[model samples]
Target: MEIYQLVFETAIEINPGAVAVGAALGIVVGVPLGAAIAKLVQKRAERGVKGTARVGRLRAKRAWDA
Candidate 1:
């Protein structure tokens, strides 16, 4: 087994602390984004249900008239 290390002063430095903070920030930002998406999906589902009910009512009325 051999380990290779590259030391470059011009390379971008990656700090573990910064990565952890970025992960935490991503979760903080994602929670509300997820909630907003869920709300939109919920509204879309409700609209679908309402549209189905309206179609059902129209069908029933047509059957009754016939």
Candidate 2:
């Protein structure tokens, strides 16, 4: 959540302009970025779900290092 919030917050800081163009640009850039993040996280979750399902496995390597 913090990461996703940071992405939008950075975009707004860069593109804080008039309503039409700023909104258009934000949508153009933000949607794909958000979707890509979502997909990557989803993939990671899926790959690690089995191995990390146990509470004792909380610090185990996930898809990022598995």
Assess the local accuracy of residue 25 in candidate 2 as a C-alpha lDDT between 0 and 100.
Answer: 87
TM per candidate comes to 0.50, 0.43
In model 1, which range of ten residues has the least summed lDDT?
1-10
Clashing pairs in 2: none
For model 1, the local distance difference test gives: 0.72
Candidate 2 colliding pairs, count = 0
Query: What would the per-residue lDDT of candidate 2 be over residues 1-66, giving only the tens digit for each residue?
Result: 999779768867776665457678889999999999999879978887665457445545464376
Question: Model 1, residue 59: displacement in angstroms?
Answer: 33
Relative to the true structure, how large is the alpha-carbon lDDT of every model?
A: 0.72, 0.75
In Å, residue 50's CA in model 2 sits off its true spot by 9.6
**Best prediction by TM-score:** 1
Worst 10 residues of 2 by lDDT: 55-64
Residue 19, model 1: Cα distance from true site in angstroms: 0.8
Candidate 1 differs from the real structure by a C-alpha RMSD in angstroms, to one decimal, of 17.2
Residue 43 error, candidate 1, Å: 0.4
